[model samples]
Target: MAIVALRAPLKDLAGGRSEVKVDGASVIDVLRALEAEHPRIVGWILDEQGRIRRHVNVFVNGELTREDAPLSADDRVQVLHSITGGTA
Candidate 1:
């Protein structure tokens, strides 16, 4: 199983938590499983098209991962904000 750590800002929407783990053969596979667990976090990390949103950054083992990035059971996934600021 790989671990998916959700940042604090996003965690607020996930019942105020820090991290979560999911089982998968790839990042996308684990993300799908995570969505099943934290359904609310679905839109937060993924777009309506079921793809990772641009604003939300996903990193594997501290390195940003692209759609084609390969994921293994030993990898770790983290979801965070890459945005700077919004309306004040």
Candidate 2:
């Protein structure tokens, strides 16, 4: 199982959890498992087409990665939402 770390609102959506354990061979699989456990995080990580959102970033073992990236049992995954704002 990989340890997935949730940031900001994602963590809030996951019941205030900073980390979660999930089993998967790929990043998307891990995300799917996370969604299964926390339905509120559905569209926050993945889109309607099941793709990672552009405003969202995912990292594996501290390196940015795609959804299809392979994973190991001890791997760590981080899901972060990009903060955006406009100058007044």
Question: Best-fitting candidate, measured by TM-score?
Answer: 2
Q: Tell how far residue 48 is off in model 2, in angstroms.
A: 0.8
Q: What TM-score does prediction 1 earn?
A: 0.82
10 residues in a row with least lDDT, candidate 2: 79-88
Model 1 CA deviation exceeding 4 Å by range = none
lDDT at 60, model 1? 96
Winning model by lDDT: 2
TM-score of each prediction: 0.82, 0.91
lDDT of 2 by residue, 1-88 (tens): 9999987789999999999999999999999999999999999889999899987889999899998999999899998765643245
RMSD (Å) of each candidate, 1 decimal? 1.9, 1.8
Q: Candidate 1 — what's its lDDT?
A: 0.77
**lDDT value, residue 81 of candidate 1:** 77
Clashing pairs in model 1, backbone N/Cα/C closer than 3 A: none
Model 1, 1-88: lDDT tens digits are 8888887766776677777777887777787788788778777677778788877788999998865577877687888777753555
